[model samples]
Target: MKRKKNNKTGLYMLGGVVFIYIGLFLFDSAKALQAVEEAFGVLKMVLPIVLVVFFLMGLVNITIDKEKISRHFGKESGMKGWFYAISAGVLSHGPAYVWYPFLQNLREHGAKDSLVFAFLYARSIKIPWIPLMVSYFGLSFTVFFSLYIVVASLLQGLVVEAFSKAKR
Candidate 1:
């Protein structure tokens, strides 16, 4: 039953995409073709990364003990939880949406709301981009920006925790 629902959801999303392209083509054929070409270009770049991410996610789902996640990232895990979340976020690559399902699983397994927020915020600092950023903006600026993002991510987590608690 659940599988059927999931299939339907996937079909709906696929249909939506098809509808969008059709609409665009109807409105302006040349522009629509251009958009399709641009989309394919992006897909070529992103698909490989997405596939690797999914493969890794599968490994994680199989190997990582759910109890460990709950123990470390639970509401009472405190600063250590924040550190782990931020670190994971920084190390994560590929598009953000790719992380959503894994993150949602973490949440379901007792990961704190604050840590989730921290993880999302800390994703801004891509390690691979550091060299390019330094070259473009200078070492001092890049270093400072990275540090600021780390700090801001922690702060954002704290604020999210506070707000969540208040709402509850």
Candidate 2:
């Protein structure tokens, strides 16, 4: 029932060129292209990872226990509810866009959109990424950022619930 999005890489590239032209008025053309190409290269690698992760997640989702998840989530206990929100990230990996289809399916299956959003924010704060971040930002920065991610993700879920109910 949903409309599919067309591939818009050409449009994005064209827009990038326009932005590059304007950027050159204040910056260097060669440097800008190098920066753009570097960014594009990152995207090129990221897209495949995203696709693979999404596919795996989609398959796992179809094969898993929906009833148990539904039961646990429908409860009123605060800690349990919060735990469900946090634990959602246990399976999610890769970039944000990769998780959209899964989240959309969750929403269709009675998942609160806020929880789905929070789950996503939590995914970015993964413990696996900590070692790399620790080497770059030191322990304190990594710790604080991790805490911020958890809190923000929880708050995002809450806000999403508030907005959805309000809209209703």
Candidate 3:
């Protein structure tokens, strides 16, 4: 029942967007076409990344056992869990929003809130940007900044863990 309600809500939102677009088209066709073209341009850039993330998610669902996820990312996972979360976050590419669903899936399977927060926070460290960062900021500053980010990720995770516990 709850899932159905969510689906309905999503559909309604999409409908609202469509309606607005229709109104835009009626008012000014030129602007509407430009808006649509811009929308499609964004979609074209995002589609491949979205497809890859979904494909990886499907592979995880089929090949990896839920129990394993729980074991590695659950409350009892300790430092090992932090390692996994940070590693996954650092390795993950594309927009941070793109990983929300995948992270939600992990959470549903018993991953801890702390781990999730850590993963999201660690996404700040972009491996591909390291070279550019070093060139502009120097290797020492880059290294220190990266280390600071990791520490900050851990701190964020711990804060989230405390809040979750308080709520419980």
Candidate 4:
């Protein structure tokens, strides 16, 4: 059986494009084109980083066993589980949306709420940006900021776990 198509999203996208074109025509055409070119330039710069992150994600999906994930991240996994989650989060790359599916899979496989929160929160610290941060903000400031984020991530996880428990 053929399923009916959802037109809402398509309509919204069409409306957005229409509005952009209208705005372009109403304003300076040359400026609008320039803006578009600049936006594409930024996208070109970011595309490689995004692609690499997805590639690594694919590798992880293929090599990591579901049962092992459950064993390490399950509700009964304890502090060690939190450690693993936090470390993974710190090392995780790409946009937040890219990690959603993996996180959902972990949740389905019995991962604890606290560990999940820890992972999500710890993503605030991008390891690859550390050198840049140090260069821009001084090593001492960067070190402290990173340490603070690590502690805050753990605390955030605990708070989320408490709230989740309370809800249950």
Candidate 5:
């Protein structure tokens, strides 16, 4: 039964390619190829960085106990969760994508999904990026956005928690 399903899936994939080719062939073939090449170029550039990051992440996973990390940052006492989230946001480097493995590790170690979401939200509201955002949007909008993001992060955690409880 599974084999029959897999064959059907393969046939569907081939049909999709034929459909796409028909569309592109009837449309602008040159533009489609150019877009494909540009996408491949982007993938080529990112692959090496991702490989190195993955390697480093493997080392961290092997060396550290993520449960300890969750214990260190997951505490909500004395506004510590916010501070931890903010500090982790600032001190962490590289693309936001890089943090997923670590965040997943934290989650496996009993960190709430909302806390992970908050960390990422806080990271996006980077302190250094504030000047750039202010320069582009001006102080009023920038301040509002910043405050909005912080409140939203905590609220996000709470909402997700509520949803999880509801699911049970």
Candidate 6:
């Protein structure tokens, strides 16, 4: 029943988008065509990332054991879990939205909410940007900010854990 409702909502949103496009086309055909072209261009770039994410999801499902995921990211995972999550976040690249499905898959396999939040928060510390940041803001500022971000990620995770409704 919930799945049906979700599908219905999706269809409605798609229909609304189509109708809006139709209206735009009628109002200004050339502008509408340009909009469509830009939309397709964005999709073309994003599609590959989405495909890679799916491939990674499948790889994770096939190679990583559920018990291992739980051990690393689940309840009682301790500081080790935080370390893993923060490390993964810093290492991960590409748009953050592309990771949502993969994260959801992990959660389904027993990843904790706190760890997920920590991962998301830690993503702000882009390792590749560190050198650039240091050049612009000085080494001390960059280093301190990076360290603060790590601490903040842990706090964010702890807050999520405190309010999380999911059973461990």
Q: Which candidate number maximizes TM-score?
A: 1
Number of the top-ranking candidate, with lDDT as the measure: 6
For candidate 2, the lDDT comes to 0.69
Instruction: Give the per-residue lDDT of model 2 (tens digit) for 1-168.
Output: 234566796699889987866787467777777777887888887787777767756774786555654555533325675677677664455667766766666545445556666677788776777799999999999989888888988888788767767877
Per-residue error at 16 for model 4, in Å?
A: 4.6
Clashes of 4: 0
lDDT of 4 by residue, 1-168 (tens): 113457597799979987997799679888888887887897786677667766655765787766776679875678889889899999976766567655765665567767878888889888899899989999999888889988988998889878878887
What does candidate 2 score in Cα RMSD to the true structure?
A: 5.3
Give me the displacement of residue 52 in model 1, in angstroms. Answer: 3.3
- Residue-level lDDT of model 5, residues 65-113, one tens digit each, is 6556566654432267656765676555557876776666566655667
lDDT of 5 at 154: 81
Put down candidate 6 lDDT per residue, 46-85, tens digits, no spaces: 8888998999999889999889888989876888999999
| TM-score, candidate number 5 | 0.64
TM-score of model number 1: 0.82
What lDDT does candidate 2 reach at residue 8? Answer: 96
CA shift of 128, model 3, Å: 1.4
Per-residue CA lDDT of model 3 for 74-161, tens digit only, reads 8778899999999999988888988877777677667888998899989999999999999999999999999999999999999988
Alpha carbon RMSD to native, model 1: 3.6
Stretches > 4 Å off in candidate 5: 1-26, 44-49, 73-79, 90-98, 126-129, 165-168
Q: Which ten residues in a row have the lowest lDDT in candidate 6?
A: 1-10
Worst 10 residues of 2 by lDDT: 69-78
List per-prediction Cα lDDT, in the order shown.
Answer: 0.84, 0.69, 0.87, 0.78, 0.69, 0.87
Using Cα atoms with residue i matched to residue i, what is each candidate's TM-score against the true structure? 0.82, 0.59, 0.80, 0.68, 0.64, 0.77
Model 1 lDDT per residue over 1-168, tens place: 011226588789989999999999999999999999998998897888778777766776887776777779986677789889999999988778878777776776668878888999999999999999999999999989989999999999889878888887
Candidate 3 error regions (>4 Å): 1-5, 23-32, 135-141
